[model samples]
Target: MTLAWLCLMWVFLSATVATLPLRIQFIPGAILLVAGPVLIIVIGLQVGFVFSVIALAAYVSMFRNPLLFLLARLRGRKIEVPR
Candidate 1:
């Protein structure tokens, strides 16, 4: 029950962030990006690996662009952000 609520809240927050300007979305989006994996781990512990994997795939799809940008930075590649 608690996990379900948290997942719902996460989805709601993500949708809200999507509506904001790109620059403004970064802070909250970044927080969510960090929180997501932790939440997945907890969910795995509570539920099971299969559900956690599904959640991870969904999360990756949802945050693909931000994840890609972070990956580029980690790899020492320059990524241009659109203004």
Candidate 2:
């Protein structure tokens, strides 16, 4: 299913980002953090809660990077990672 592919890709991207050296790792993490919510919003609109949850988890993991966290905090929003 499309949702399954999305989840798989999310895992792959996360893993690939994590394996990269520090200088490059941030790029993929930033991509995941920014792009994930958009993907979630798109899929969540048509699919269901399951895909949204997966996307949210990936987004959180991406944003968990300290640099990303500080950016999010600067904007003054709660760093939500589901329940």
Put down candidate 2 lDDT per residue, 1-83, tens digits, no spaces.
78668767976887888788777766677777666677788778878889778767757765666656678889997895432
Which residue pairs collide, candidate 1? none
Clashes (backbone N, CA, C under 3 Å), per candidate, total 0, 0
TM-score of each: 0.95, 0.60
Which of the numbered candidates is closest to the native, going by highest TM-score? Answer: 1
User: Candidate 1: worst 10 consecutive residues by lDDT?
Assistant: 22-31
lDDT of 1 at 22: 84
lDDT of 1 by residue, 1-83 (tens): 99989988998999999999988998999999998998899889999999999999999999999999999999999999987
Q: Give the 10-residue window scoring lowest on summed lDDT in candidate 2.
A: 60-69
- The predictions' CA RMSDs to the true structure, in order, are 0.7, 6.9
lDDT of each: 0.94, 0.73
Residue 36 of model 1 has an lDDT of: 94
